[model samples]
Target: MTNRALVIQDNHHQTFDNDAFMQARNLKAEYCNSGTDALHAIKSHRYRCILVSMDMQKENPVEIIGALRHAENTSGLSPTPIIVAGKDFKLTQSDIGRLNISAQIRSHHLK
Candidate 1:
């Protein structure tokens, strides 16, 4: 089975360094440079790991994450593990949400 990961980022350019790190680990990543793109992609594919950024969509990644979770809740589809990437954002809501499979990846560590 392919261990694919979906990463949602508003600025794919600003995320290059982190992408390289994931690639080095042999992770197959599907990145969307905007929330709109990510939402469209998720409707078409399944990912084991989901990485979301707070700065996405000009500062509305929360909506993207919520949308994913909502899809699972309403459709009874299996929820993928999510890794929220950001500086000011916290995982509290994601933890309590329907997506029990989740984690956090700080953006600053992209250095």
Candidate 2:
């Protein structure tokens, strides 16, 4: 298995320094600046984990998780762990259960 991760973040609101995180973890990372690109990357590659920025402007992080989950289901792939990263977004327990999110990482924790 590849020690790789997919990072989905909007270009404009890049608050988290994903490179530093990846470097610290000793993992290779593929960055997707949009949901469309992220979807395409998810289809083509398998990641150890996916880190999605919650501060996206064009796409809702929940929506992205839903789509990725659906794709994994239809493709008969194991669910990849997803970690939501952001500064001020709150994910309700209901949303977390529904989305099957693996974990969440606040920006402060990353630093």
Candidate number with greatest lDDT = 2
Candidate 2 per-residue lDDT over residues 1-99, each given as its tens digit: 889999988773577778888999888989898878888998999999999999898789889888988988999989998999888899999988888
Estimate the TM-score for candidate 1.
0.74
- Residue-level error in angstroms, candidate 2, position 67: 0.4
The residue ranges of model 1 lying beyond 4 angstroms of the native Cα positions read: 57-59, 91-101, 108-111
Candidate 1 lDDT score at position 73 = 70
Q: In model 1, what is the error at residue 76, expressed in angstroms?
A: 2.3
What would the per-residue lDDT of candidate 1 be over residues 1-111, giving only the tens digit for each residue? 456788877776653356665776677888787767777777788886787776565757766777877876777767777777666655565354644636666666765
Clashing pairs in 1: none
TM-score of each: 0.74, 0.93
What's the distance in Å from true for residue 96, model 2? 1.1
Q: Which stretches of candidate 2 lie over 4 Å from their true place?
A: none
